[model samples]
Structure formats: structure tokens, C-alpha cells
Target: SAKRSVVSVSALAVGDKLPSDIKLSYFDVEGNMQETTVGSLTKGKKVVFVVVPGAFTPTCSLKHVPGFIDNADKLKAKGVDTIGCVSVNDAFVMDAWAKQLGADGKILMLADGSGTFTKAVGAELDLSDKGLGQRSRVYSMLVEDGVVKVVNNG
Candidate 1:
């Protein structure tokens, strides 16, 4: 018999460098959809990147997102440059959620609409059984200069 080899891939973790070309969408101040890359956001900056399964969900809406919004200033004071909240939803939904939660200026609402960014980071969450389709796994990371220094996933 021939020997078989198995390779295992894992989600983004500490010491991993974020992919530079992974694109995400966001609604700008003028309500225009804007495209940005993770590398661009984390370049030469200390970013607190948060990922939620979906927008407007109970936990995300009531706690996860709000926690970041409420502590935005404190995070900034602790040398955080940007606090980004990313969800597997469209830019429009993300913008609306941001407005509804009063996170308009405090957090950068990022939309991984097509799950491109989520898949790239190996954080895809399959919720098809619940009819929610593909989504992102809940996680938070400290990214600096395009490199992940710390990561927490749930």
C-alpha cells in the first residue's frame, strides 16, 4: 500500500500575516459602497479586528458589537488605531446596523458580503442547516502592521 499524507489547515492565528489582497466592502459617510483591503487597514497601525457571524443577530447586536462600541475610546486610549467590526453581510446591512447601534463613528463596519475575506482567513462558518448560509466565525484579533499578534475565537 502507498503511504497517504494528510495536511491540515487552520484559521488565522497569532504570528500569521493577513492576506494583502483580501477585499472587503464598507459604506462610507456619503452612503457610497467602498472597497478596502485588510492589509491597507492594518498597515502601520494597531487594529482591533472583530468578526461576527451575522449582522443584527441577538448576541452580535446586543453584546458583541456594542461592547466594542462602548469601549472604543478605551481601546483607543490603549493605543488602538482602528476598531473594525466585520460581518458576513452586505455593506448596506452593515451600515444600517452600525447606525442602529450608534457605532457609526466608533467602529468601522466591514462587510464580507461574499465570504471572500472569511474564507481567506479560514473562518468560514457553515450555517446552512439553519438557512443562514455561509457566515464568519466569531473572533477577535490584534493586528499590527498586517500581522496578527493575538487571536481569540469562539
Candidate 2:
């Protein structure tokens, strides 16, 4: 599938404060709705927020999501708090996808329908060629207590 908007993350790095105050919603694969508070999600432990252009895309479905989903237990053993999957889609879409991928319980699927959070983190992607406009880049960030620790496999 082609993407319309591409998203990118700029100037955010380790030790820098994250904008956890942003409001967002996400959906499970079963089409359930969920509203989330970033701050509360990162209350303690390390957080890994992974952003993708879409849920069922070739790369994301076959590799990206699997990498984290397969390694979720390993990360937890390392004291990691949570894993988030974000996209510029609606809560229902995200929710449905998460459930489809069995990520409803392990991963936090966040919806950035307006691209507000995606732009804030500088992870916006430019997918004009593919038709996904201004969506987040494929990557993951490790945040500790609302501060960035590292952006992995970006």
C-alpha cells in the first residue's frame, strides 16, 4: 500500500524530555477503543515507543512488528516497561490491527490521526510518492521516566 503522509522525529534524543502530555487514542485488533495519557503510560520503567506508517504494510507486518513482538519478553526481562506501536490512523484501525497481531495485551497501539504526536517527536515521514502523507518514520525510542534514552533501529 502507498502512503500519503510521511512523519519524522527531529532533535529528540537521550536525556531529553518527551512530550508525554499529548493526548492520543488507539484501537485493538478487535475494534475496541482506548484513550491514553502518555505521562501515565510512562510512569515507571523504560518505555519503547515504536512508530510505523501503517499496520498491515509489508515491512511492518512481516518484520518490524514481529521484531518487537517476538522480543517483548526479552525486553521485559531487561526491565523495559512497555512497547508502543503508533501510526497516523484512527483508534479503531489501530485497535483492530493490534488485536490481529496479538499486540492488544503487550503493545500500546497509539493513534495519531492528526499527526500531532508524530510531528512533535520529529518522526514524521514523507510518503507523497506512496500516498501516505506525513506519517511517522519506522523506528523505536527508549524513554525513561518521560525522557528519551535512545532511539533504536531508526
> Which model scores highest in lDDT?
1
* lDDT tens readout by residue for model 1, 87-145: 98999999999999999889999998999888998988899998999999888899999
Candidates in order have lDDT scores of: 0.90, 0.79
Candidate 2 on 28-123: residue-level lDDT in tens?
445556677778778775888888888777888888887888899998889998888888888877777777788767888888888888788777
Question: Could you tell me the TM-score of candidate 2?
Answer: 0.84
Candidate 2 residue runs with Cα over 4 Å from true position: 1-9, 28-32
Residue 100, model 2, lDDT: 75
* Worst lDDT 10-window in candidate 1: 4-13
Report the Cα lDDT for candidate 1.
0.90
RMSD of 2: 6.2
